[model samples]
Target: MRPRLHIPRPHRRGFLTAAAGLLGAAALGGCDRFAASPMGQRTLKLGEDANLFVQRLLLTPASLAKEFPDSEISPWFKPNGTIDPPDRAYKALAATRFEGFRLRVDGLVERPQDLSLSDLRALPARTQTTRHDCVEGWSAIGKWTGVPLSEVLQRAGLKPDARYIVFHCADTMEYAAGGEEEPETDTTANPGMEARPEGAENQASDSQAAGAEAPADEGDEAQGIPVRYYESIDLTDAYHPQTILAYDLNGQALPVSNGAPLRLRVERQLGYKQAKYIMRIEVTESLKRIGDGGGGYWEDRGYEWYAGI
Candidate 1:
């Protein structure tokens, strides 16, 4: 029998905390708008670049992330982000327990190859109990087993020009809904209500984005589009020993609730940086064409790209 991974129900206090967080989300939830705006995106990019520069200067090969003993692994590790990807291809793989799943390793590499589940397991593997920190106020320790990403990159023969390793994932976060009109607070009363209400344009855009349905909404996220989710990291983090494409968690085939098949476990960054439902690994020197041309899915939504903490 497959090992069972349990998730506990939140208590009353936890529920209240969640409710409070949701209320605060409205005022703080303009990430999508910030990502979409040319000015806003440029500003966020500067911040990302600055953060990356600082991290690089302080980071060293010897600066290892903290690890815990097996005894410290949590009794339950609740899945974050998209648990069951609604993608047809991902569904098919899950149906057969991902028997036919193959992780495509391409994008600007000298030796591009598709590594199957067995192929990944056959490679040298490292198992470590590490804590996953989420932007949300919660965390958990899980023992993950997978091959070091550096080993795979070495075999793939990374091109010298490749600077960033972009992770294309299967899970989509939102869909273009039907007739969900952008809420407009037109300030042009008789064409004399000048000045756009002081950032009215920005407010209108943000309000409309809030109406966008998440991927888990009724049926498909949208008509036929997949809710795109992806992330990117520097080659340095890609080659980090702790960074691995995990296929097994807690001593079992990675549960569907926690990114089955394969997922990127970027140990040094926040949970969102660990892109789940991993599909492809693209190596590019620039982030000019990766999903609205930002750094990651959340980053595209205005979340800090380099969530290194």
Candidate 2:
């Protein structure tokens, strides 16, 4: 039987206060445009150079939040968005208990790696029960166990030019119907979007293309599926002591609905930044070339790329 965990309401209030404070600061500084309603415009217009500078300035090793005795842990850790991915490949892996699942870590590194779940578990691990704060205004606390992202980067050996780490996910969002299909002539072509059911990916791709041409409808693209929920963190956040790739929760193997095989644990940011169904990690200098030049799937749709808190 699992132990009952308790999440204090006061902690939730504190988390909200901190988040609002950060968002408020961004707003006062004219950064609120990044978080503008996704249904309006779907792009971050901060420009590459300025965005890079901000990301650099925000980079800092994350300090671990204070921990509590085992008895104080939360009893229930509710699953976040898309608990079970609709992707067949992911479903198959889950059915088999992720026996063959592998995490590929590449890009801007001296050594690239393909690590299995067992391989990750064999490494030294860190465990902490921290609050999971969501952007939509909700929070939960869970005990996560995994190797520090810094440790993984060290093993991969980051190149000097590596400035950001991009997380690629397996989950693809379904968009509204209607739109023309364009052939993939370049890297920017939506790979995952194109693979979606007819009308879904095409509509999404068209909105993205349209958003690129006219910033007016960018909000529409934001309301739609934005490149499938990818996120990037600066080198500093990548090395934060609290930043981990969690594999366990509350002393047990991670549940399938809760990013069973593995998921990122970036405690300082909102929950959306903690991507699940992650398959690839790429190190890059700029997000301009990643997905629609927005740094993240959601960022491509107007969500802030540097979601600092």
Among the numbered candidates, top TM-score falls to: 1
Against the reference, the lDDT scores of all candidates come to: 0.69, 0.64
Global Cα lDDT for candidate 2: 0.64
> For residues 120-229, could you state the per-residue lDDT of candidate 1 as single tens digits?
99999989889998777568798999888887887787775778888888765555445232222222221111122343322111112324323443335345555477
Residue 234 lDDT in candidate 2? 74
Residue pairs in collision within model 1: 31-301, 172-227
Model 1 score (lDDT):
0.69
Off by over 4 Å in 1: 1-47, 176-213, 216-222
Root-mean-square deviation per candidate: 16.1, 12.9
Candidate with maximal lDDT: 1
Candidate 2 residue lDDT tens string, 1-309: 211222112244444444554544445555565445452122223333234344444453445555667776655555555445545567678778889899999998888999998888888788988888766655667788998888888888877667889998765444344443233222222211113333331221322422432122212343344344477887766777888999888877777656668889987777767877788899887888887887776666656676655
Residue-pair clashes per prediction, in order, are: 2, 11
